[model samples]
Target: MEKVELLEAVQKEEENIIRWRRHFHRYPEVGFEVENTANYIAEHLEEWGLEVAKNVGRTGVVGFLKGGEGKTIALRADMDALPITETKETDYQSENIGKMHACAHDGHMAILLGVAKVMAFHRKFLKGSIKFIFQPAEEGPSPGGAAPMIDESVLEGVDYIFGAHLHSLYPVGTAGINLTNMMASTDNFSIEMIGKGGHAGLPHESIDAIALVFRMYQEIQLMVSRNNDPLEPLVISVGTVNGGVATNVIADKAVLTGTVRTQSKNIREKIIQQLEDKANFISESEGGRCNVQIERGLPPLVNHESSSLMVKNAATKVLGKEKVFILEKPNMGAEDFAYYLEEVPGAFYWIGAGNKEKGMDYVMHHPQFDFDEKALINGTKIFIQTLMDVWN
Candidate 1:
């Protein structure tokens, strides 16, 4: 089938697409609690006559649509929501308090489902197999859902995998298909400082742990500027700090938790080592003690050439050559989809959902974050095009 005809088939399912997205959005679930989401997806996959597997990675669901059984291609959609509360006033706003699909995983699921509908209808034309992966916990409660899914053999015998994210960084009609790197590697660290406490009036009698933590925070940036290569992308941010109780009393204990992001694993390791070393040095100098813990997160997402080329061509064919964009640089944001790329040759694309006039320009993970619903058609078509164009 031609690209336009396939997109037409997807467009016919627009109502159901929006229905699925809103249903998931209203009843948002977080992390491994995607039981409802998985069951919902599994029911649809089974209805389409696809072989369904539930709880592959706890709550993850994979649907296999075997055509001629030549090669298998995986299409992944994350099924988790963030911890933020919904601020939008729409009727479809989250019914679950303190949980929302702020990152647009709802849209991701809808797009994949739309693709599944189209693919199942056209299964006669498809020469290979298609696996629809509805993953849990893409928004990490650390280590993420992709690694566990892979551990359960999700990527076994998959020749090529394709994934897409709906981002509010560009206008709704455009899309980003990077030639190489898309997102950076992300890892987290926490530091706890222990010291002697005393009254504010006392100077030498008290060891200020908060002061040591502040100094360590300042020194971490030097690891990026002075130690790593200037061209190498790296970011260190302290997201949380807790310690002192009162202004009159010096803090005896303090804690700092943050994240480290880099494009290179070597740089990631070097920066982590410097963080621990600096924390120890600063604490000891202040007559205190420090403990640093580093937890590894997702690896950097780099698109393989063949799969990337397939997406680039399909996106260009669907949207036109002018609307197709190659990202100027990779983002510091991380994705668990990187784990799938580690196992198979795959590419993850970005479908633009930003429209300033529609008040849909909020970025992902923001409390007011949302996208133009029209973008769903484009995302759905892109997935369809990529799959059909894979063999061509």
Candidate 2:
């Protein structure tokens, strides 16, 4: 399948692709409450001649296309939107108020749906099965859509799973991927300090909670600098800190909240336990009580070498070799798609959606974030090429 042939085929259905994307953009849903979104996706999948299964993982829809199976491959598109109020003015701007598809999930769903329609029409040409997975809660309420879908045995016969995310950093017509370690795991930690409050004028009358905060900040940096491996990428950032009410008063309580990111699971665990140890040591020694809280988030996404190579070859075939390139390093950003790669050998790719000329190059999660719809066609073509090449 040459790039021109694939592009032409996908372009024929460009109107429906844009329509789907705009519809999702206008009416966005967040978390597992994507009922209308799930139904809309299911209706399309069912009408496309694929066996549709709804509520696979609580508001998630799965379309099973059994095309004279050899090996089963799952294509996933996230269905959740972010909890951001739309700031960009457009015809398809979010009407759902306070919810927007700022992460380009609207485009992801549109691409996969477009691929499904094309694959359904050419079912006889396929040698294997394709599972169209429309998942919910990618932005999360913890344990994201991928985990629950896996728990429901969504990948029971799946041999290789593939997922793609729209990246605003890359320009239109280019796709980027990493051979391994596509993204890092995210873990959250919070420290609460309690001490006796007193007037600032009285020097040694009270144990200061604010003092413990700085001491613990130094200890956290030391943990990252001295305890963790330098070769491995690790980041400990305190996003928020709260203490003290007045300038003349010594605060009795303080709270520090932040996130920890790492690609290696072992290193992530080590750093997490070390944070608790460090916070406890500093607070107790300062005659103050401290409580530590930890929340584990998505696992690191590491792509399989063979699957990655296949995607690279398929991408090269669809887009020129010059348009396809390997990423230099893994991203510290987290993705729930990491869950699917854990159970099945798979690869995740970046579908470039940035277009500064059209003013669609805002970074993801920003209220003004948007993407070039032209990239949706490339995403569909790449997916089509990847599947079709499997049988070639």
Candidate 3:
């Protein structure tokens, strides 16, 4: 289909797309418990006469639309929500208390469904096969959904894969495209400091674990700033701290939990080692001992050059050259989609969903985050164009 006709077709289904998004938004599920969400998606795909596979990676769903004997392309969307209560007062606000689609997965699903709808109707014109992947637990449980799906051979025989994240960082009508390292690697660490407990009034009688951890936090920040090269991006942040139970007593133990984000593997390894060493040194110097635990997470998301070129050309064709934004820097946020790119040549891009004038500019994971619904159509059109550009 031509760009104008394809856009008009998506516009015709705009209301249904919003309806599906709101339905999923109201009943958000987290992690691997997205059974109902997966069933809903599978039902739609099956209804469209596509071959469906349920529970490929525990709760993920995959739909195959085979048009001819050619290369297969996969389009992916995450199907899990965050563990946050809905604070928005909108009518479609989450009915599942304490779980919300704060990261715009609902929009992602809607856009993919819109693509499925368009492609299913125009299957006769398609020259190849398309796989629609509804992945679960992207918000995370260790290595995340992508890894498990890959283990199940989700990328088997796939030629190219494509995915997009909806973001508020850019205003609506712009798409962020990058050639490499679109997101950072995420790794988490925890430190436990142990010391002698005593009355708060008698400081000399007790080794202060709280003070040791506090000092270690400051030292870790300094280590990141002074040890790494200025050109390399690295960040270490302590997100949680826990210690004493009583105000009048010196705590015998304290724990610090945080995450490390870096674009360089060597720097990531160096920072992890430095963090453990620094924590141990600081605690031992202060008459305490420290234990460290690091849980390595998803690798940095790097966009393949050929796949990125396809995305850029597709976006430019669908939305014009002015609407496509070539991002100069990658985001510190990490995505499990990195695992998919590890095996298959693919690119992950971003769709602009923020509209400041509409009061829809809240960042991801925020309680009040939302987007202009029109971006769903924009994303669907871009996805369709990318598929056509690739398969033709």
Candidate 4:
């Protein structure tokens, strides 16, 4: 079908897509424990005449639609929400307590479902296979759902893959895509400081673990500033510091947890090595001991130029050339979609979901975050058009 007809088909499903979004939004699940969410997705995919597999990555679902013999292409949608209670006063406000679809995952699943239904309807005329991946735990517990799904050989025969996010940064009708280095790698570290405790009145009797943590924090910021190149993008953020029980008694131990963001692997490794070295060096020199642990995360999201161009072309066709934009810089936020790009040629683009006129421009992960529902139709159209571009 032509792009216009494809867009019209998606428009016809806008109501259904919004209905699916509201259903997922009402009962949000978090992390790898998305049982109801996974079941719901699998049921619909199976109903659509697709070969559905549930619990691939513990809580992930995959739907396989075989078209004519050709390379297999995959489209992914994350199926997890945040651990926040909804404060939005909408009718579809989260029915589950302490869990909300603050991020656009709800909308993402809806858009991908719209694409799946439309593409499956044209299955007989398709030139390639379509794999619909419903991933869980994107908001995450280390490694995330993408890695687990990849470990289960989810990308086994996939030739090209595509994923999209409903972004609040752009207006309601524009799309932003990147050709290279779309997002940074997110890594975390923890530091433990041990010292001797004493009464607060006795100045010379105890070694201060909190003091040592302060020094280590300074060194971390300094390392990022002085040890690394200025042009390279790197962020070492100290997120949590826990220590001391009483104000009168000196603390014996302190723990600090922080995150690292970097666009280059070499830079990421270099920063981590320096962090461990400086932390231990400073702690031991001050009559205290420090232990640093590292948790590696997703790699940088880099889009293939050809695949990204396909996305841009599709966005232009669907939303008009004036509405499609090339992002000037990469995002500091991390996404597990990076994992998929690492395995196959693919592109991850942002769809404009913000609508300032309707006050629907809240930043993602906020309690009142939501997007213009019209963006759903535009997103599905882009996904379908991109598929047509790739398959043809």
Candidate 5:
């Protein structure tokens, strides 16, 4: 089918897509706990007569559609929500307390379901097969969801993969395409300081674990600034610190939890080692014991050159050339889709969902984040056009 015709078809089904998205948004779940979401997706796919696989990688749902069959292409969508509570006063505001679809995974799922509908109807005309991936926990409770899905063999036999995220940074009706790195690698670390506790009034009697914790935090900042290359971008953020039962007592133990982000694997590894070493040295000098735990999370998301070119060409064929913008720099945000890219050649891109006039300009994961409904049609058209282009 032609691009305009495919877009028109998606437009006709806009009401159903919105209905599905709101239903998902009303009952959001976090991380690997997406039981209802997975069931809903599997139910719909089964109704569409596609081969459905449930629980591929802990609540992940996969669907398969076969046609003339040259090579298989995978279309992926994340199926997890954030832990933020909804503050937006809409008819479909989240019904579950302390959980919300603030990151637009609801929109991503809707777009993929729309693609399934269109592709299912026109399966006879397809030159190859299509795999629909409903991935759980892109936002990650720890290492991330993509690695688990990859371990489950989700990318096997897949020639190319495609995925997209809703972005509030760009204006509505616009899309971003990148040929190189699109996002950074994320790693987490925790430092624990152990020392003797005593009365605050007697400074000499206490080992002062709090003091050591502060010193370690400060030294980490210096390491990022002075030790690393000035041209490279690196960030070390200490998000949480807990210690001390009372203000009058010196804490016996202190815990520090934080995140580190880097663009390259080598930089990430070096920063991690330096962080551990600095923490241990500072604690030892202060007469305290130190323990550091470093956990590697998702790798940087790098879009292949040829795959990105295919995405751009498909987008241009669907929407005009004026609507597609090539990104200049990689974002520091992390995506679990990087795991899939590690196994196969693929492209992940951004679909604009910001419109100030409609009060939809809030960033992803914000309490009041929302997307323009027009983005649903735009995303659906792009996926359909891209699949047809790739197979042809």
Candidate 6:
């Protein structure tokens, strides 16, 4: 199909796509607890006469559409929501309390479903198999959802893969593509400071954990500034701190949790080691004990140049060349889609979701975050057109 025809076809299904997106949005599930979302994906794919597989990587659904001889391609969409209260007072606001589609995974699933419907209808024109992956837990669960899905052989025989993120940072109808390092690596760390407790009035009798924590936080900033290279992009954020039970008593223990983001693996490693060493040294010197736990998260998303070129070409053919935006710098946010790219050579691009006039400018993961619904149709069309461009 021609680009216009493809977009028109997707536009024709706009209402149905909206219905799917809203339904999933209302019943938002977090992490690996996406049973209803998985069921809905499976039913839709099966209804379209595609072979559906469930229970892969726990609550993940995979649908396959086979065609004549060629390379196999896989398209992925995350189905997990965030653990946040819905603040967007829309008719389709999340019905589940303390859970919401704050990250726009509902739209992601709908776009992939829209593409699956198009691929099913045009299966005869396809020269290769297309796998639609509805993955769970992209947000985080220790090792994340991508590695488990891959370990379950979700990418078997898959030669290439494609995925897209709805970015609130960009305007609707515009797409962003990067040829290398589109996102950073994320790792988390926690520190527990153990000290002696006594009356707050008796300072010399007890080790002051609150004072120690404040010093530790400041020292961490200094460590990054002095130890890391001036040219490297690195960030250390201490987000949570908890201690003390009562105002009259000096806290016996303090807990601190934070995250580190870096552009390269070498810097990531250096930051982690420095964090541990600094925390340990400070706590011991203060006559207190410290335990640090560092958990590794997703690696940086490196976009393959060839795959990105293919995506740009396909997108230009579908949308106008002027619609595509070449990003100058990678965002510090991390994605588990990097795991899929580790096994298969592919690129992950962003679809713009910002529209100031429509009041859709909230950043992702915010309680009031929302996107322009028109991006759904545009994303679906681009995916279908890219498949045709790649397969033909």
Candidate number with greatest TM-score = 2
Q: In candidate 1, what are the lDDT values of residues 267-319, reduced to their tens digit?
A: 88888888888888888887799999999888889899788888988888778
Which residue pairs clash in candidate 5?
none
For candidate 4, the per-residue lDDT at 126 reads 75
User: TM-scores, in order shown?
Assistant: 0.92, 0.95, 0.91, 0.94, 0.92, 0.90
Residue 297 in model 5: lDDT: 85
Clashes in model 2: which pairs? none
Model 5 has a clash total of: 0
What are the clashing pairs of model 3?
none
Tens digit of lDDT per residue, candidate 4, span 257-282?
99999888899888889888988887
Candidate 2's TM-score reads 0.95
Span of ten consecutive residues with least summed lDDT in model 5 = 1-10
Cα misplacement distance, residue 147 of candidate 2 (Å)? 1.5
List model 2 lDDT by residue over 97-125, tens digit each. 99999999999999999999988876666
Cα lDDT, model 3, residue 198: 98
lDDT of 5 at 30: 92
Whole-model lDDT per candidate: 0.88, 0.90, 0.90, 0.89, 0.88, 0.88
Cα error, residue 200 of model 2, in Å, equals 3.5
Runs in model 1 deviating more than 4 A are 1-5, 195-208, 242-252, 284-288
How are the candidates ranked when ordered by TM-score, highest leading? 2, 4, 1, 5, 3, 6
- Cα error of candidate 5 at position 350, Å: 0.6
Candidate 3 C-alpha lDDT tens digits along 1-392: 25566768888999999999999999999998999999999999999989999999999999998978877999999999999998989989999999999999999999999999888987775788999999999998778899989999999989999999888878888888888878899999999999999999999999989998899888877877788887888888889999999999999999999999988778889898988999888888877898999999988888898999889888888778999988878889899999998899989999999999988999899999999888888899888988888877
* lDDT-better candidate, 1 vs 3: 3
Least accurate 10 contiguous residues by lDDT in model 3: 1-10
